[model samples]
Target chain A: MATIETTGLTKSFGDVHAVEDLDLTVEEGEIFGFLGPNGAGKSTTINLLLDFIRPTSGNIEVLGIDAQERPAAVRRRVGVLPEGFGFDDPLLGREYLEWAIETKEADDDPDELIDLVGLTGDADRLAADYSTGMQQRLAFAMALAGDPDLLILDEPSTGLDPNGIQNMREIVREQAERGTTVFFSSHHLAEVEAVCDRVGVMNEGELVAVDTIEGLRESAGGPATIQLECATPPTELGVADLDVVTDVAVDERTLSVTCTGASAKVDVVTHVAERAEIVDILSESVSLEALFNDLTDGGRDGDDADSEQAATEVAQ
Target chain B: MSVRTVAKQDFLSARRSRALWFATTLFALLAVLIAYGSQGYRLSATEQVQNTFRSFGMVLAVLLPIVALVASYMSIAGERESGGIKFLLSFPNTRRDVFLGKLASRLAVVAAGLTFIFLAATAVAVARHGAFPVGVVLGTYLVSLLYGSVFVAVAVALSSAVGARSRAIGAAVGSYFVLIVLYLVPTIRITALVQWVHDTMLGMEPNPHLYDAVTYTSPYIAFRKALNLVLPTEMQQEVFRGSLEAGGELPVYLTDEFSLVVFAVWLTVPLVVGYVRFEGSDLE
Candidate 1:
């Protein structure tokens, strides 16, 4: 069964369409990453799933329950680290964890959850006075209170350092290992790349792509570039028959080849070695960051006129 | 169960407030001072006790509402503005739990403060006069609590209805002006204006009962009127007492029973209005 599902979900604030016609589903025990840039409706979609805001039109179900009709019941089984949340009250870190436990009627120990989040030493301090990273860790501990079946983290690494972000990745991995489904949103491609089993990319309040990293690379069609320092440049390499090679160039003793897919690089290397003596091989794989930029940029440039038309229709 | 947990969390957090402690201590000190100063009256023991109670009640009428308002006006609105309520509602607790829990917590704080003040006053009276009017003190404490709850309900309702802390503060201070200050400070001018309009503009005879009705609309006045149910009859602060002594009957609306109803209205109406708004609003 799907842990979180939304069909045609949309939310608008006056003239602004924060989320539009969003359809999403995260299966149980799967770590699904939600990716988007700023104002791309990632957080707004999460908010709609959690029932923090009402949808303009559509349905949302979490844990197979209608979110809008019984939000508290949905939340009872789901743990959330909401975006832009703070500890304005004067409760200590442990106190907040304890409150979460008692509120959820869970039997988990507070100190253990604190230890899980690497906040054992800071659990006795006032949460309001903690640094931003410490507060994020505390919020994570609170969300882990009940060993909830599903965890929704919105920008969970907003204020973390490099080490803290690494720790967050490990904690998320550990939770998923315990058979918990994780739904996390982030603009950072590397963060999602490190832990997600599948990803959904959102742009302009609409879902642009949903696939595994490999599938995304395939659909994005980013090329792998291979450079060779050969013993000597050879003319007529006879590599023209290869389909994956997009381009090939040789200057003096150097040869550069651009191609798609992993095996194609090996194929190109073999083709080059058959014709000349090879010295050194240098290869560059496609980075998801560049792919992400391309995807979002394409959304903006390609759909500019379409979105304007939709806005006018909405206005009418 | 969720309501109780939310209430407990709110109360524990509120316990750290310096303002709550300061107000509690201040009221207790004032009670002690009133007890010591009232010893010079030459009346009988009962009369002197009644006189001291009247003076203390007057001070309490002003102080309790302000304390209640200040303590409660920021309960929901402040958290909403600071994005802390997102952390709260991220759990399984409903909006009703949050609203009623805050009301319960503020009511508990006000009740705890009243306990300190009344205990201090009773202790001093027992030490100085060698007497304790158990019924009177207890009754007066309950009445003060009801009055305090009225203001707390008003303030929490204001907090829940608005999205911003500044708006809540504006509403709270605005309510203080309209309900307490206007009734307490400019009584003579307001009364003269009402009388002039009633007699001159409308060309009608002056009705003192009209003044009583208008004044009693303020919770402060209604609270004072309700206290007559507990205090000695001679010491009761009843409106229209002069005309009643001259063979005029008091209107049912002016009776102490109706003031209790007024207290009831003030308590429930604001809560219902606030809950309706709070339940439907988006947390963003």
Candidate 2:
């Protein structure tokens, strides 16, 4: 079953539209990354899904319940890690974890989870005494509590070290493997690229693209590159004149050519062989970077909205 | 955790804090001194001192709201400001459970504090007057406390409404001040129409009458009236003797039980409002 489905979701704050005409669906047990820039409507859309804010126009169903009409029912089955959480209480880190278990009516080994977050030592200490990272881990633990069916994480790795970042990615992967639908939003494009099975890119309050990383890369632009190293130089090789060729730069023993497509790759190899010593030939595929740039920069001065950029932009 | 568990933990946590210990010690000392120092306390001479303490001490009308604001109003907002609320709310618990759990904890602490103060006061009275009207004191204390609980509930709602730390703090304090302006003082009650619209928040009926209605409306005043009603004939005679005027009637309204009903209403109304808001609020 689809864990979440939103039809034409729209939210407005006064005159500004934070999220508009957003249509999205997440399958069960999938790691869906809602990727966007800082102001992209990712968080706003998530808020709407969680029923933290009402949609100006649209319908949302999460966990098989209407988001606005039955938020508590949906909330009971979903775990959320909000962007910024603050509280002052004397409860220990582990105590908070235990409280989550009670709230969800689920049995969880808080000690084990605490260890997973590297908060074993601080388990007995008041949350106020722990460092920000430890506290954040505590938040993550809470989200994991009750073994929720659907997990919603918003910028979950904002305040973490490299090791912490790795643990976060692993934790999400582990949950997804366990059949927990994972829907999260992040401004960290690399993180999204790494673990996300599919990504919804947004800019200026709209989703421009929603597909796998490979699909995005393909749609972004041309794939791979061909590098040629020859036995002879002095502009002897016609590397730049080929129809498929875009630009060519020669440094000593190597020739680097930018091409529109890989169609001309064979002809270039033959040309290099005829004019110079075919010492080595290297070809590389186009990266998401290239694709993202092309897809986002296609419009004139943003006159034409880039699907990926529009997906990432938050109206508010 | 169960509500009981939440309340129990709150109690244990409060016991560990220095604030509780400090406040308790002060109450103990004051109670012992007052009980012993007033041996054969006569009404006429003591009334002067009683009135002074009445206006200055914690039982003043203003104290109840202050206690509620300080203890419960800041509960959630403080957490949000420190970024700890996110951790708590992330749990599978509904916002209602979160609010109720915290409310239960604060109430337990407040109840403990009120109980201690009353016990100490009784101890002092016994030591000085040779015998204390325990029933009167106990009855009055309950009435006053029920009224105070109303503030706690409303304060919690206010705290939830204001999410940021500094702003929440200001709102709590400012609302408390507004309450005082509208509730304690009568002349100021005569205000511009806008002021009435603002003051309507104080109460739907506006406590109606101030010190006079304190019996059925105000917590401490209601408690005082109830205590006077429950006092034994001998103590009543003694109380009458100790009045500011040697022979005057202490105000009485339909016996002391009216105070209990008013206190109940005071507590029930605000709690209902808070719970309803909390159950449905977005809490973002």
Candidate 3:
């Protein structure tokens, strides 16, 4: 069964459309990464799923239950780590975890959850006094309460050190291994690449692409490069003349070939080997960064400068 | 059941608030000192107790609302402003639970403060004269609890109506001025305006019952009138002579028990309206 499903979901703040025409589905136990830039409406869509904000028009189902009609029931089975949340003052970190456990009617030990987040000694201290990273860890432990069947994490890597980030990722993987569906949202490509089974890319309040990392690269048809170290300084040998190959550069005893698609790498290698002896060949597949840049608007640019440049172009 | 957990968590937070404790202590001390100071009037034990009730009721009418508003005005809005509402709603509890739980906690805090103040005042009267009116004091305390709950309801309702802390404070203080002071006081009572309109436009004599209708609508006035239920017969005449002097049998709704209904209405209407606004609006 699908853990989450949305149809024609839309949310608008007056004239600004924060999320528009969003249709999404996450299967049971799948780690689905929601990817976008800073202002891509990723948070807005997550808020809609949790029913923290009402949709302008559409439907959402979580764990096969209507999210809008019974949000608290859906949340009872799903744990959420929202973006930009603060702990209530005068509450200890351990108290927060215990409160989560009590509220969910779960029997998990708060001490064990505290140890999992590495806040054993600091759990008794007030959460208001904890540093940003410690607070993030505490929130993660709270979300782990009740052994929820679904986890919705928005920017889980916001204030984590490298070790903390790795710990969080491992915990997420462990939860997924327990057959818990995870909906992870982040702007960081590398983090998503590591754990996401499939990713959906959102841009300007619309979903632009949804596929596996390798599938996105393939479908994007981005540039792939191959380096050839020849027995001597090699000639182009009509490598650039081939329609698939985009650019060819020659250096001392090495020839580099850039191609637009996967087929071009084989064509370039065969063409080079027929003419000259190839000593060493290294090929690199396209990175998600490039595909992401292509899918989005050349990645995030300075808004002021981009608008000014656009204004000048319009004037011209 | 979820409301219990939310209320418990909220109460635990309120328990640690030094500001609430400080205000309770200050109010208790002031009430005791004022109750003892009224001894300068050479009076019998009964008169002394009546004097205490009169002075305490007057002070409570003015002070309890401030404490109740201070305790509750930020219950929802502060959490919303600090991004804490996200953490709260991320749990299984619904928005209704959050709203009602917050109301419960604020009421509990105000109830505790009122208990201390009333007990202190009663204890001082008993300690001074070695005996006091037990049933009357208990009845007065019950009515005072209802009165405090009315203000807490208004304050929490105001808190739920807005997202910003500044706006909540503004709304709360504004309501206080209009409901507590401007509706019954020397500045300009709503009844005075209505009486002026009655005399000028309708060209009629100033109707005393019309004044009673408009004046008793204020929670402050309703509280004072409700005290007539517990006050001795003579003291009741001294407090509520205006209606008695009207020289006609009063309407049933104008009775002291009817003011309880007024208290009930004030307690409920604001909360229902606030919850409707809260349930439909988006959280940040």
Name the candidate that leads on lDDT. Answer: 3
lDDT of 3 by residue, B193-267 (tens): 787889888889878777777777889888988888888776663333456687788877678878899999999
Docking class of 1: medium
Of candidates 3 and 1, the better by lDDT = 3
All candidates: interface RMSD: 1.0, 3.4, 0.9
Q: Candidate 2, which CAPRI tier?
A: acceptable
User: How much DockQ does model 1 earn?
Assistant: 0.67
Give lDDT tens digits, candidate 1, residues A1-316. 8998899988899989888898898999989999988889998898788777889999999999998889889889989998888797888989989999999999998998898888878899999999999999989888988989999999999888888899889989989999999999998888899899999999888888899987886676556678888898755787656898988888888788878764588999998898889999987665666567656764444466653332222100
List ranges where model 3 is wrong by over 4 Å: A299-316, B202-206, B237-245
> Which 10 consecutive residues of model 1 chain A have the lowest summed lDDT?
A307-316
lDDT of 1 at B3: 84
TM-score for chain A in each prediction: 0.88, 0.85, 0.92
lDDT of 1 at A249: 85
Q: What TM-score should be assigned to candidate 3?
A: 0.95
Model 2 over residues A83-126: C-alpha lDDT tens digits?
87752566787777786777677788999889887777889988
lDDT (Cα, 0-100) at A111 in candidate 3: 93
Considering DockQ, where higher is better, how would the candidates rank from best to worst? 3, 1, 2
DockQ of each: 0.67, 0.33, 0.81
Pick by TM-score: 1 or 2, better one: 1
Off by over 4 Å in 2: A222-225, A230-243, A250-253, A261-279, A284-286, A289-316, B1-17, B20-33, B39-62, B178-265, B272-282
Q: What is the TM-score (0 to 1) of chain A in model 2?
A: 0.85
Which model is ahead, 1 or 3, in terms of TM-score? 3
